[model samples]
Target: MNQNVQQAAAPGLGIEVSSKVPMHWYNLNADFPEPMPPALDPATDEPVRPADLEPLFAKSLIAQEFSSERYIEIPQPVREVYSLWRPSPLRRAVRLERALGTGARIYYKYEGVSPCGSHKPNSSVPQAYFNKIEGIERLTTETGAGQWGASLAFACALFGMGSETWQVRSSYEQKPYRRLQMGVYGSQCHPSPSELTESGRRLRGQFPDTTGSLGMAISEAVEVAAKDPRTHYALGSVLNHVMIHQSVIGLELLDQLEEAGEEQADVVFACAGGGSNAAGMMFPLLGQNLRGGSTTRLVAVEPAACPSMTEGEYRYDFGDVAGMTPKLMMYTLGADFVPPAIHAGGLRYHGMSPMVSHAVHLGLIDPIAVDQERSFEAGVAFARTEGIIPAPESTHAIAGALDHVTSGAARPGEVVVIGVSGSGVLDLAAYDGRF
Candidate 1:
């Protein structure tokens, strides 16, 4: 190693490298012990065929949604774009461990370095690419907390395609900067429950004064895309393809851990909303565990206010309020349930990802929920020690890790990994009364 490399490799500072980006995305379905329940067509109460998804998604994404391939090659164009921010650093949280006074070794994969300051871009770029290649002129989608909207807008801008988003009313009001970010990326943004679509108008009439939900926003976006042949919908999470695209995170982390000389992680913690972040960061490791190559415990942390995995029932439910999308089999707290307006807006969804739900059902994933106050407390502590303010959604994982340590559940010297899905730079308002 060079002089600077030798210094960086010194014990206790955590390892950071930039050359370990994965060339392929690992598909968890290939390693799943059983076939996940297929998405159901609401009209027929039968399995949804790829043809049924034709109006919303590009052909390439639809193929990936149904694919059983173990590893999908990342396209050269997509990889070229990813090179700008791929291989995000995995840092040992020495300061955080010291603050907690715990012997357990904590590490975090920091994904805030991306252009959108979140992991959403991992999938958004590819989603845009696939749509552009298929001659789609514009993409429409929903957002909660605006990360996904900004990400898709950024990706669309890169591909020279137009984009539009319907953001949940709560986040649109709370995070105005996110909408500005989207606009800067050359996309149009609207608040959910606007009068533009029938779904939005109906929702507005039904709940006039209420804070909107991700489900509601999804209904509006889906309605718009279904009506326009030149436009396609790009979902940020809760599907097979999104999770597969996110696998780059876990794939890169695994390589980084080996390079940093860690044998294996005892547990991996990641905040789960629609489940893309957790799935992207844990699926590769979980696949190894399923195949008997590793024994890492995969933990999906969620907001207690909308604890789908922890408190919901596993059943077929609509992914959106208006039921415009297919009924997916997963852990759900009713399609229309509106969670309390918490700072972690990104995690206020009513259902979990089907793959994550299946993994939880089979006991492959341990799901946990953290309340708002405790999560914010953990985020503050981590920021004070590590010098990076975590996104409200990412705080759930920090809280989960702290819970494991403070509760004496983590063994001394055990290796723990957390996925810091994003930065809270633009979310400073969320911390106004939080601290």
Candidate 2:
């Protein structure tokens, strides 16, 4: 048994916590038939060595990046912090199923219970812990919808560290409260494409009046981290370590399904952004499926406005717009592409996670793109039925499940699980237009 795992239900919030949050996070690398591609340094055109990233990331994180372990033990300090909101409830969306008039049973893993209101903190707490123990004083990173920024900020405050975040410009303007929330958690926040870094300056030169994307924001944040010896970059998604840290979501879901008396989900869904949330929820399922057990269908829902999985090319591409990070083989819509300022700010990234892209390439899961209107409609219907307002990023999942029921593809009594990634309480402005 994992030492930090809770066998008994963690009590709070008047909700049933059916499973323990695992002390060891799962890593799929050991099980993969082929190792993930090694990122190459643009300047040297060589496979990026651990020492090459020493200046930009904690050595511990760098080791985890290349590790092929099936499970990495979560530091006790990190697990202590996770006790605040681990084992988030897996709810059967009975009301939603009835509202949709579907015979398929719908379940959701609600991540909004966390203080940062998303699964971002699942990685943030551990990332902050790694940096703190490594003698790093401050962390720098980028955000799209501010969930990642706010999560890291809260974790840093708990660890008595500091963080600087460059949030996407559109989200900065649309979600002012997220910036204020970061400040409350003792982190400084700035709009991306700010004239603070050379990467930001170069982007400004090209698109002086354009909304910023995650790729652009990552470039700005990486520039700052690479320059300061005391500051290291902490990415929100699309990295191996980040995705591994997020396995807690699926680890809990594994037990939840057993408690719910379901054999396996017929289909599991999550909105794909940089792909952390979907990967987090689906990775364990894939592991089970790969082992010749559980034939659960995995699905990724992406925004049509920035459909990296559905319309992008499968090739080696830079993770950022400025070509600072290593080249990853993933589905990309061109790193330089500036996505339209859609309401689902988090889904505006140009490329998918390499692991997720590889999974799609192998035909392990299916990807579908949903437009703004249908996502919002599904979100509204879910709110009315389930009494929980989902984040715009999560609405894509709702829309995906809704599509199957309406199309008469979902059979009666089939089980469907959706990842309700976060709450939209801070995004009332986006909902105001509807009212």
Candidate 3:
């Protein structure tokens, strides 16, 4: 089908299926997993604990709700912007099923159709809406893979607001297409530690060839946002509000599953960076769990190079792009530890989302970290079978899905849903190397 025709058919008429079982759901609770035991900071050798997260958690955008008529009404402007790419589709992987030759059914909710080509816009649009309503003039943020930067830029454009982005140095250098994409959306992109802020300057002095980390980029963005009263920082992932905004994915998936005549998924999988996309996909599933569905396995996949959930310590750490910002209690690898340059740049973070980390710690969810080569292998397999090239970061989830299927863990007639958070069109170079 043509793009326009497909877009037109997305919401109501594209497919009509029914749910196998009647299931009721509930709203997400504000309460989350308790903090793990504190770890000592390597730099200062001080105890890092959940108590240190008080200030950062207090500032989370998700912690608050919009109180405007437009927020409640969903204005035309907002609808117009969303209609451009809202309501992404949930697709079943028939070809993948043939390839696996397993009795299991595979499905994926595609979020690559967004202007930013990822699920980031789910939050970006709402974030822009609230900020514009609050009379904010500009937005600032850090970008590791450029998906978040592009999403913010697109959202700001919808609101006629300017945006500034500090891209991680490795991503800025390695993914020119991503940087260009951000620029195309009218956001200025600078490599972090570019003498832009005090943090960057100090870091540059320490290591002249430093490739900026998310921690550093966050520091620069926070500096800009805090210094300018008119500007607000927009984060692509983590935080409750961002995850809540992304619930549209799961919400839509529920409707799509009904259309396909499927019931509860046997397993759900999504890539975990800062955890917005994963949480978006799984939270609704968790809601299903709350309603007493049989244990639906929820899996979070991360990069082994930056395995915050699997290998890192849960402790209080700064959430900035640099180590300069206020601390948040989270599972972190270490702010100063630079991860190896991996194709999944977005997954190279040193920390996990507080909510996601909390969930994992409480044993409410499970996490696994995969190496780059294996992830790329899964990406290739998915592209060949499903005819969709997934982002390197998201390929981790695909990798996990493949492992689950190949292990014969899922029986025939069981279902699996993978969140293909973004397309890998901009990542052709990475694929070229793998193929």
Candidate 4:
């Protein structure tokens, strides 16, 4: 058995601990397949092999690497800023186990305590760090649930830079706490398809009550960022670098589990929107798999309303709310598609992360989609059991765990790890309607 497994099986103090594994940048090209073309546009459809993305790929954060002793050092200032929230906690979910009435051991690596109240800051801090190091003075990005906006705002503030965020319209109206959170972090947030940009104005003109989409917000943010040299666009997910940055979560979890005296996880579950959180939690485990260790099932849970990984075609697609950004190969429903107005607004995107899409295609992971009602049911159950009201986005994963437990799919002594990516304190309104 691997050291992790051995430690997990050993008896002693139940505190989890992680090995000091040296951090390294993963080779994106080696792990992922060649990019494909967008499926929605046939006239412009064409293959987008990894070679074709050389220019864009070169700009990836992983592509720029340095080492300072144990940590593969990113550029300065960004690294310095990241020190503020570098190490997040990997927690044991004993509360969840008592609620499940199952013999399986369960743990959750909580990512809600970060400045932005989600795992988003894991990437946002790095993105802003790099942009500032590159002499950029302003950052622009789009937000669905406002977690990303708040994270970026916090990062920009740490780096003495300015940030502007385009919030999805439905989310802006439905999740006021998200906007308030972003505003607290010093980001200027505006509802997407607002009167601020021509695209927003035109979009509102067509769909007045349009609960904005990620694609539309991306179009506006990218337009604004690309227009000025001082401003650079930042993405919350859907890129290899973002996933790479998020590996810290898994790194910490690996240690935490060891401290908890548990063997390797039998199953690892996470909710995937653009796939950053799931990828982060899975990357270190992927390293274990590559080492010819015991196979631990990796699962990605998403909403049925926007089941990009489960139902969408693996093809090139636009990464924006309005289909205005450069197209990339990924698993996508459609760039023009609009998801249901679910409380998990962050998971409403029409596409999966390219790396996640590639991983799913290669059978490295499994995808499951649950509906809003069911997800909320899971979230409420988790709250009652775990005592942490999960964000709607994370409830999808909790629901999946509940399914496994209630169905008796997990055996006694088996272990399951779920990524509780955020807290649902901002989602009290969602709970008000649930009961």
- Among these predicted structures, which one has the highest TM-score? 1
Candidate 1 lDDT, tens digit per residue, 1-435? 366644422222332323556778999999899999999999999999999999999999999999999999987777767877888899999999998989999999999999999999999999999998888999999999899999999988777788999999889999999999999998999998789999999999999997899999999999989999999999999999999999999999888899889988999999999999999999999999988889999999999999999999999999999998899999999999999988788898999999999999999999999988999999999999999999999999999999998888999989999999999999989988777
In model 2, residue pairs whose N, Cα or C atoms come closer than 3 Å (at least 3 residues apart or on different chains), thus clashing, are: none
Off by over 4 Å in 1: 1-19
Would you give me the overall lDDT of model 4? 0.75
- Model-by-model lDDT, in order? 0.92, 0.88, 0.76, 0.75
Which of candidates 2 and 4 is the stronger one according to TM-score?
Answer: 2
Summarize candidate 3's per-residue lDDT along 308-351 as a digit string, tens digits. Answer: 99999977776654554445567888878678877788887788
For 233-323, candidate 2 gives per-residue lDDT tens digits of 9999998899899989998898899999999988998999999999889998888888877999999999999999999999889999999
TM-score of each: 0.95, 0.94, 0.85, 0.86
Task: Tell me the lDDT of candidate 3.
Answer: 0.76
Lowest lDDT 10-residue stretch of candidate 3:
63-72
Query: lDDT score, residue 367, model 4?
Result: 94
Between candidates 2 and 3, which one is better according to TM-score? Answer: 2
User: Which candidate ranks first by lDDT, i.e. highest?
Assistant: 1
